[model samples]
Target: MNLFKMLRCAFLLMPALFCYSQTSSGSTAVVSLEICSNESSVDLFTMLNADAVAGGVWSPSLSGGQGIFNPAVDNEGTYLYTVTTNYVTLYEVEVEVSVVDPIAATTTSTTLCSNAGPVDLIGFTNDTSNQGTWVPELSSGTSVFNPSVDEPGIYSYIASGACGTTVSEVYVEVIDTANSGISTSLSICEGSSPFNLFDALEGSPDLGGTWSPPLRNGSGYFDPQRDAPGVYSYTVGNDYCGYSSASVTVSIDQSPFAGSDAVADLCVNNGPVDLYAFLGDGPDAGGSWSPALSGGSGWFDPLTDQEGVYTYTISNGSCGMDTATVEVRLIDTNNQPNVSLAITDLSGNNSIHVQIPNRTNYHYSLDNINYQSSNSFTNLSGGKYTVYIREIEGCGFFHKEVVLLGGPKFFTPNGDGINDYWSLFDISNIDYTIKVFDRYGRPIDTFDNHSIGWDGTFNGNPLPSADYWFLVNFEDGTTKNGHFTLLR
Candidate 1:
């Protein structure tokens, strides 16, 4: 050993390096330890106050001059030390040591069912000095250290400890035990009030629950009228457990019309109108027709359908349905009249009488060319005349030729049921005169009116077979003259 080296071992009581240099003035040397294990040896010679040393030993050490201050052993309290120097000044090196583990982490997390209740983060930490706190505090400090309700995710915990604050991460994973039993989809009528999805969830946690893309009522209720149709998500968390999520689907269904009533009018002979044509838009359009049908489905057929009231119903989805009531009526206009004639005696007049029901809307005319409001014609000659009947209300008219009763010129008075008398069939109450003459235009037999007709004879006796001439006057202002043959 060198002379100085030998002297350093003899004076120092602990393991360390001793260096000595002969000089009039002394200089200081600073030593530093950048990295170290849990417990490590610190060099005492490198931290000497001066390069020149006579002899020295550190106090508080039994057999070593090495000063040791480990964060693990002494905690965070201070440990004082002093070194006595046998030379001009004391050769001492002051050092501070800390034991900070790079990766020392105990699970600061605990788990619970979503409904289990608040989690105590303080109880979960193994670190003696500090209580753990959750980062990104839930709902802004509402669930900071509480598990009662928290957002579900990987949460970090920082526990202040004696050996340099160590970070312990706690993984809180929440299970949907409460909401798993409930249904996720629901339906509501359109234009209706919003329904709350939270109300449907079973056993769900009351706290730490949040809805995404919130609704007007703050995310829980679904309004079909104002909200867009889509799926919504809900998340619930507890401090003890992480978090759970569920989806809800909001479906809007169409509603039926409030009321449908219709009325219509058809000409007496017109038709059955198509019921669906009058019905406009509705919830359930193109619906089925009731009461069965023929070739025309959903149509009203005038030929087969009777004139009456009817109904159409629109059946919506499932049991929803709407009914429409319809009323139908008809307008009638037609006149059919009965015609009769009355004959008068001597005056050769015939009265034409027309019988019509409800004369209020009817008019009659004896001549087809002209029309009159009267229903009777008087003093008409023996001839066929066309009569016109008109109903003015509906602008409908009828025309027909009427035959007037006239006397036959000749007849066989021999009786045997053959042309035994000269008579007129359709005689009226008007005056009429018939004169039967011989070959010469002399008057022989006379007849007047519908009460009597001339037999082919002079007085009451039968006439011989010969040609006869006759002159008859009608009740009207006209007369009839004719000739005929009499056989005996």
Candidate 2:
């Protein structure tokens, strides 16, 4: 072929081939996104290089060689893009954009109050890139849903945005009104026993309240006498059939709610103590004592009363009752009477009377065989005697020996173990003045501290054994004369 002719032909084929290349192999892009169905993506052509593309026009006026996509065509379809480089010739490209209805695409559950307002379904819209529309035009094209009008149930809506159009249905539940009151229990007077726990419900539609700390009769009732008084827990379902728990206090009518039992102490042979003095003197405050007694009025006779412990039930009609015990103590005087005798000229008194403890009836006796009422022995001879006394009551008789010491009688200093020294051994424990004489009374030496002596001596010299007369004076200005043998 000639060069000029071939060049002309080559020049003629270049435009068609260039147009075909431009039409067939236009640049393409694939975009993916997830956005709320009520929103849309930016213009698609801005993502492509439109200025570098050899294109005359956009078929949709919104498309180009590297097309600008319109979410307005929210359905999946092939979009045509073209441009005229050489006049009268067209280069075409296809932008296959697949739009989706993301409406109903979301699976979500919702909870709502029956008194709620407009609900927004946009939060449940799965695809957020595509610009779509919502169904049930209550929101028109607005993706906001209204639960007030739409009601509470599974409802569907369509949303369009930049990502895609989708249909979504979500569960909506309405909480119905139930019993909203604070509590459901009851309290009643303790005097009124055997009252039903459920019967005391106030402001409650459901009256069936159950109780813990059940009644003593094994029933659902409250008994002051049978059931214990305290805080009782109860559980009652609301009007919605849901349960709530609470408590109430039951009490008795008494000054000291805690009852104290009575207690008493009685001496043996003593009359019974008046029960009213220990117990309250009220119609409500009464006592019941078992095993009847006999004694002075309002008193129990300990001597005649039963030997066992006596129990009294102290009762109050409103406060209930308690018990008390009285313990009886018996005294004994049967032991020997404690007695002592002192020789004295003062006040006509000669004997000391022993005082017995816890004893009521007492008697005394001077003579060993005969009992007397007088405790003192007056003007009696100074001698060894016996005291016999007994209580007129249960106490028995007692005997004690009494020794009366006068001026010292004859004492022998004969070196015998018995009465060895001419001393007043009986009055040795007392203070006295004693003098000695050789048959002719003389104050040889006044003795006070020591009474062990007179060894039949005169001025430190051994004297013949003889009867020596002695003068003794006591503390009470009373003088006595006696004789002592000083045999050696």
Candidate 3:
């Protein structure tokens, strides 16, 4: 009976030994795993036990299963497990639990035209790791990204998890360069006409741009209807990209109304009359007129008034003139024609001529009682004589005093030959002293001697029959300067 009791006690302790051995087996080791939240990259942490199991019962203590470890997160072979047991026996088994971070996410950097707004990258992420947590390095929640920088730079994004983190960068560039140019045409001349360049740069962009050739009639923009002829320039640009410029040449035409001439007529009767002119036609055509007149409808007539000849001129609007002239006369009214006599020989050598009214019959003689068909008489004796003229109902006479004092007829100094030298008349009683001068004002001769008479010679050279000046002192104390022709 005592031997039976000892065997029974051994059988009771066997279950307890199995439980201890299983708990201390290799299956009781702790294991762990990690995963990135953004990229889903996984990492494994394995714990191996040092004891072997004898029974098939295993268990693990809470304190023994807890420990810190580091693992590399990657896509290759991500599964991990661990067994837990009580004591040295394999009593129970348990698998390891892994805590994965949210999947890592990534975003593509954006490219935009210059001046375009910022890009939104809020929802961009990498979900390969099945992680929910995402974080940004360059920006915060709902932050925008701007790739349009003044200078080129790189953009970056980063995601992290309990296991690891990832980094990505994208190159970005901003450009605002543009082609700038201009064009225009112009017409010019030598006058005061308005210039225009409005038509230049038509069909061009003007928003956020500036135009030159400042507006004369409208805004600074070049509009064909607004600008005058001239030169112009234009510029355009963006806030981030800066600006560009272009030049345009404009031309304007000369006015047709330049340099016009005006003309009018001034008549004796009509003071000033309108004279129509063509634009640059006649000597005085083509001009503007005050109180305007119709073309070719202006004129003047002299019979309208009795005033003297009227005058007018054609002028260049600024300077210069062309002129014209006219004349008038009187009429005669008488039944008996008028007649007059004249002497042609002013030197008084017995030569004479006459003139009579047109369409008249007349005659003349040296005596009042005598009449002849001859109209002239010549070479008569040097004495007082009467000249008579006879018309149909009347006869008229004129008398002239003549004295042949110093010629061959009166002062003949006859010796055996007749009339050879000159002799003095008895003019001493008339209080006369004759003096003669040469052409150069030199006193050459004087007639104070009673018997001295000139023989028409100077310095023994016979004087020619030409006019010579003489001085005669009269009895009245007045001097007479006379011009006479000498006769040979």
Candidate 4:
């Protein structure tokens, strides 16, 4: 070292080399230093004043005159360096050493979602010294950790005090939160085909989530025919966050089924009948009828209703509606026939002709099963008969009971037991108004069905034997007008 000082003295002409040699000329300097206990040994010469010279010996004698200060081994106090010539002190400097135990390097861990806001990386550690710098530098060029932009890992926070640098490890784990996507609603027909429920979601959803109230097959597929319609939920989770859930509302619509068409027969005078009774099979209820009725119901009134095709309709929202038709026909029971039969009963030509206004519009039948277009029906003998008259246009049929009187053509009212009175045959209990007129059509007699036969007399006087015309008026607006002979 002495030889080195002599070389520095030879270069005194260079001011940069010989300017700091003023310490050898009896100069005093002092300095204070705070160093970390874990730091490397510091140079005592560097801590001294800039004008201080080298080749100084420390009071706490360092080996080899190195002027090194080690905080780990040295105590916290003032360290003195002295320079002497011939054992007389020429320069002296004080170095106050402060040993600051490394800010207690902490190991901390923090978990955050990638969507979390920015935070100070050093805040996770217990160290209150805000002088930490992150390793691989924070992307924001600051100590604030932005989880969205910065990569997450073990970040070493190097904090520096006046002492030295301390390393803190921040185990940062930035994870993505579970996303179950957006909630939505869907409506499908009850018998619709199967489809994936995940596809029905609104936004971009995370996959591999479980469905609540699990589907029939334990999958995201929704089968309208098999699955019960209601709300379903999708849940996703991890160890970090508990869980996240979203719902999908599924609504099933019922299909509309209208029954088969039918034909009905109604009587004009039979009042109203329910049109639903005419449907074929299991028809859906609560339907509407076309050609709206006055009563707003399915009842059809033969008196005031139109006869055609009536339609029934059943509706089901977006699934559309179904329709069926009911054909209606009306029968006319009005204007029933009142007939007058001319029978040649005594001569054995027992033939009767039906009399009606419009014979063309009616068909005649003695037995209801057999019908004929002709109004005349003939046979040998007759007592009582039922005449059936049906409309040719499929309206309806009408039947009437009539007595074919088979009595003598000429009646002798001579008070004898054999031919005592002239009256209708086989009509003892029938009620009728009988009028006997002479050849000039004069009124003669009137009797009821409960009375005895006519005595062939006018005003208690015996009438002369002659051809007289008798008219029978029935209660049902039918009249039997014919000629009969009366003998005195």
- Highest TM-score model number: 4
How do the residues 145-259 of candidate 1 rate in per-residue lDDT, one tens digit apiece? Answer: 3344576666666654333445666677666543322446666677677787777554543544677778877768887778776777777654444556776776777776623
Runs in model 2 lying further than 4 Å from the true structure: 1-95, 101-420, 426-429, 437-445, 459-469, 476-483
| Candidate 4 deviant stretches above 4 angstroms | 1-32, 35-43, 46-65, 68-109, 112-122, 125-188, 195-209, 229-233, 236-239, 244-253, 263-270, 329-394, 397-488
Error of 1 at 487 (Å): 56
Predictions ranked by TM-score, top down? 4, 1, 2, 3
lDDT of each: 0.55, 0.51, 0.41, 0.74
Model 3: CA > 4 A from native: 1-105, 108-176, 183-185, 188-208, 212-231, 249-251, 258-484
Candidate 2: tens digits of C-alpha lDDT, residues 27-136: 43222321122334324333223443454454454422234443543433544545555564454445444443323477788766544566666676565543445444
| Cα lDDT of model 3 by residue, 1-488, tens digit | 11110011111121111001112234333222222223221212212232323233212222223322222322222222333364333332332434344334354554455666666444344534323332332343333555453334554545444434555444455665533445545434424334333344545543445667566654544434345555567677765666777666654332333223433323232223444432244444443333222232333333443323323334442123444322221122234345545543223455434456631465656655566666766654333334655553332223342222333332232334554544334343344566776566666567743645665677876666555565656555655454444554
The alpha-carbon lDDT assigned to residue 454 of candidate 2 equals 64
Candidate 4 lDDT over residue span 265-306, tens digit each:
776765578898788787888999999875679988877788
Query: Cα deviation in Å at residue 226, candidate 2?
Result: 10
TM-scores for every candidate against the unseen true structure: 0.32, 0.32, 0.30, 0.48
By lDDT rank, best first, the candidates go 4, 1, 2, 3
Clashes of 3: 57
